[model samples]
Target: MTRPVGYYVHHQGAGHWQRAVAVARALETLGRPCTLMGTLAGLDTAAAPGPVLDLPDDRLDAGFDGRDGAAERPECLHYAPLGHPGIRARMGRIAAWAAQHDPALMIVDVSAEVALLARLLSVPSLVVRLSGTRTDRPHLEAFRAASRLLAPFPEALDGGAVPDWVRAKTLYGGFLGTAPATAATDEDGRIVVVFGRGGEGGALGPLVQAAAAVPGRDWHVLGPVSGTGAIPANLHLHGWVAEVRPHLASAALVVGGAGDGLVTAVAALGRRFLCLPEPRAYAEQEAKADALERLGAAIVHRGWPDAPAWPGLVARGLALDPGIVRSLAEPDALARTAAAIEAMCREAG
Candidate 1:
C-alpha cells in the first residue's frame, strides 16, 4: 500500500491544516495511508486517527498590524521566511520521525522547502494551495521538482503565476469539511462581518466604527471584537466558530479582510463580499482581491474607510445573487484532488 505523509504550514490560521485534512481523507478513501504533519492554531489531533508530526511555531505571517500592511509589507518579506532556521534545526528530528513511518509520498499543504528535502531523498510529493493566490515562485520551482501540484480551487479562479506543468495537475475542488454548513440568512435583517485571525487587535477598532456607521441593518461579527468596548447595540459578537460558511450563506452579504479561508469558505457560498485588505501585506491577498474584483466575485476596498461607496456598497452587497456557491463547490472535489495526486506519481516514472 502507498503511504503519504501530509505536511501543513501554520501561522495565524488553520487553513493549511484544514485543507490537508480534507485531502488526507480523500487519500484514505482510495485505500492509501496518510499521516498529517505540521502545527497550526487550534489544530486538535483528536479529530482524526493519523499520526501527527508537529512543526515548530513559526510566526512568519504575523507581520505588522493588519491596517498598516502597506507600510510594513516590504519589511514582512525581509523577515526570515517561515521555512528558515527553525526548520533546519528540526530536520534531523523530522527525518527520524519520517523513519518511523517510512512514508513513500509526502503531501504538503503549503511549504516549498519540504519540496527541497523531499527532493534530496528522492521522495515523491504533492502540494495543496488556496484558491485565489497564484503559486509562489519558490513553490513553483519546488513544484517542478515534485511529482505533482494539486490546486483545490479552479485554476481559472486564481493561481495566475503558476507554470503550465503544475497547472496541468490542478484540480479545482470543493471543501473537505463534512459538517453541514449552517447559513444564518433566515435572520434576513442581519449583516455579517468576518475578520480574519490577524485582523484582531488594532484593526477591530476601525472596523467597529465602520460597522457602527452602517447600523441601519443588524450586524453580526465573528473573530475579534475585543477592546472595542461593549458590543455595539446593533452588532452581535461571537468568538470564532467552526462553521463560518453558514453564517455567510445565511447573511445578506459579507465584509472582511482578504484571507484564504474567507475566499474559499464564504465566496464558495455565493455571498457578495467586500475585502478590507491589509495595507502593506502579502501580495497574494491583495492580488487575490484584485482578481476577484475583476471577475466580479467580490468588491475590493482600501484607503480612507469612509469612502463614498461605503453605504451603497453595503446596499449592493445586500442584493448579491444567491445560490452561486454550489457551482464553485462541486461535489467530489476532494476526491478529484486525490485522484490527480496518484496520477502525478504514475507520470513521474
Candidate 2:
C-alpha cells in the first residue's frame, strides 16, 4: 500500500494554503494520497484525495485568552506564546494526526517549531524555504532537522543566501502555481493593482491618483485594499477574487506586493509588473522583489511614489520585457518538487 503524505500549512496568508493545494494535487496525481492540516478556509478536502483536518486557528490575533501579549517567543523557538493553549492544542492535533496516519513524509510550509516537532515525533519531514534572513538558530534548527528543504524560486536566481549545508539538502523547484498564460486580447492598457491579504495599504491612495492621471486606461485592485480615499472613475475594485492568475495573464501592467505567490505568478505569466514590497516579518518579500528587479522581471519601488513619481514608475514598468519574467518558469519545476516528496516517501517505505 502507498503511504499517504502529510502537509502542514501555515495560516499566515492565502499564499501558503494556495501552494499547499497545488502540492497536494501533484501528490494525488502521483498516486500518493495526501492529508492537509491547517486553519485556513477555502481549502478543498477533496483536492487532497485524503482527509483534510481543519485545525483550530492559533494565530496571535485569534484572541485566545492565553496569549502573552508580547512579540518575542522563547529564544530557541520561532513563535509559541507563553501559556497559549491554542498553540499546544494545535501542535497536539498535528501530532495526533501524524501518529494515526503514520504518513511516509510530512511537508510543512512552514513553521520552525512544527518542523522541529515532526522530527521529534520520529517522522521524516520536508520544510519549505522562505527568502530573507533565516539563518538564526530556530530556522537553522528546523533546516537541520528536515529530510529536505524546498525552495520555490528558480535555481538560477538563488544567490549564496542559503547556507551551503542547507543548500546541499535543498531542492530548487523554480516557481510553483504557474498556470498557462491565456492569450489576451488587447486589454487597452488595463493595469491591475494587488495588495496581498497581509501588508500596509497606504500606497493605494497614490495608485488611485496614478490611475486618475493616466487617461483611457483601466485600473483594477484585487485583494484587501483598505482606504477611505476618493475612487477614480477609471479604477475598479474587485476586492478578493477566487482567481487572480487569469487577471495577471490579461493585464497590460500588474502592480502589487512582492509576496512570493504574487511575484512567481507574474513571472510565470510574463506580465509587466511594478512591485512595492510591504514590510514582511523576515524581509522575504523585500529580498524577492530585489532579485526580480535585478533580473529585470520587475521594477521595484521603495514605497508608494509621489504624484510625479507615479508616471515615471508606470512608464518604466511598461518598458520591461515580459519575456524576462516568463524565463523564470522552469518546465520541470513542479515535477521536480513532486518527485522529491515521492522520493522521500519511497525511501521511508
Candidate 3:
C-alpha cells in the first residue's frame, strides 16, 4: 500500500513553519494527500491548510536566551539540550506515530530526531534546507542519514564546501514565503512597522523608537503589539496581517528583526529593508542578517543608522528592480521541488 506523504518541520522559528505550510498546501493542490508532523507549533501552522501529527521539537526553546544573556557564555546558540529522559520518551512516541501514519515520503526540515524516526519507520525521507547547514558532527550525521537532500536557494549562490548530500539537494529559487500580493498601491512609500513575535528582549523597543523618529511615513506593525506614546497619526498599528507580502510590496521600507521568513520574503520582493538583527538568546538571526548584508540583500542597521545614509541605501537597493520574489506557492517552485520528491517515491516503489 502506498502511504501518504508528509512534511516534518521542527518548531523553532517561523521560517520552517512557513515552509511546511507552503509545501503542504501545494501537495493538497496537486491532489496528493500529505500530513504535516511536528510539535504543536508546527502542527498549528498546517492547521490553516490541512491535518498534521503533532510531535515534540528537540530544538525547543526554553527560557534561555543566546550566549550574550550569560556570563562566560556556555553556548552561543539557544539550544535546549536533548537527552533528558522526557526527550527520549517523546522521540519514542514520535517513532511510534510514524509507524502508525506510515507516510510514504517524509520531507524533514533540519531535524535529526525526525529524520531518525523516518528511518525507523522504513519510510523514504527527503531533506529540505533553506540557509546554511550544521557543521557539527551530529548535524552532519543527520543530513547524511536522509535519502535525499534539498537546498532551497537559487543555484547561483552559496555553492560550496557542504557535504555531497546537501549539494545534490541544493536547488535555487526556492523562496519559501507568500507569493507577492498586489501592493496596496494607494499606500505606497509607507513605513512598515514589523511587530516581530520574538522572545528576545531589547530589540522591539528600539525599533519602535527609531520608527518614531522618522516623520511623515505611515508605520504598520506585523505581529503581537504593545507599547504606548502617540502612535503618530500617520503611524498605523496593523496588529498582524494574514499575508504580509502585499504590505512588503507596498511599503517604502520594512523595519523588523532579521527573521528568516521575512528575510527570504523581502529579498524575494526585491524591496529596500533595514534589518534590526534583534539581540536575543541565540545569534542565529544575527548571523543570517550579516550574511544577507554581504549578499547585498539588506542593510544590517545598528538598530538605527545616521539619517543621511538611509535614503541613499534605500535608493541603491530599490533601484535594482528585484521584481516579484516568487515562492513555493508559485507553480514553478512547487513543480520543481515536488517533481524531485515524486521521482524519489516512484523509485522507492
**Which is the leading candidate under TM-score?**
2
Q: Tens-digit lDDT track for model 2 on 229-321?
A: 778789888878767877776788898888878877887777898998887767888888888888898899987767677778888988999
TM-score against truth, every candidate: 0.80, 0.91, 0.78
**Model 1: colliding residue pairs:** 69-279, 69-280, 70-279, 70-280, 152-173, 182-246, 183-246, 184-250, 185-250
lDDT by candidate, in order shown: 0.61, 0.80, 0.60
lDDT score for candidate 3 against the true structure: 0.60
- Model 1 gets an lDDT of 0.61
Q: For candidate 3, which ten residues in a row score worst on lDDT?
A: 67-76
| Model 2 vs. true fold: TM | 0.91
Residues 262-324 of candidate 3 have per-residue lDDT tens digits of: 766676665666677766422556666666666655666756555555555455544533333
Q: Pick out the ten consecutive residues of candidate 2 with the lowest summed lDDT.
A: 178-187
Candidate 3: segments with Cα more than 4 A from true spot: 41-48, 56-86, 157-165, 169-173, 181-187, 198-208, 278-291, 302-320, 323-331
Note the clash tally of each candidate. 9, 0, 13
Candidate 3, residue 119: the lDDT equals 75
> All predictions: root-mean-square deviation over Cα?
5.0, 2.6, 4.8
- For candidate 3, the C-alpha RMSD (Å) to the true structure equals 4.8
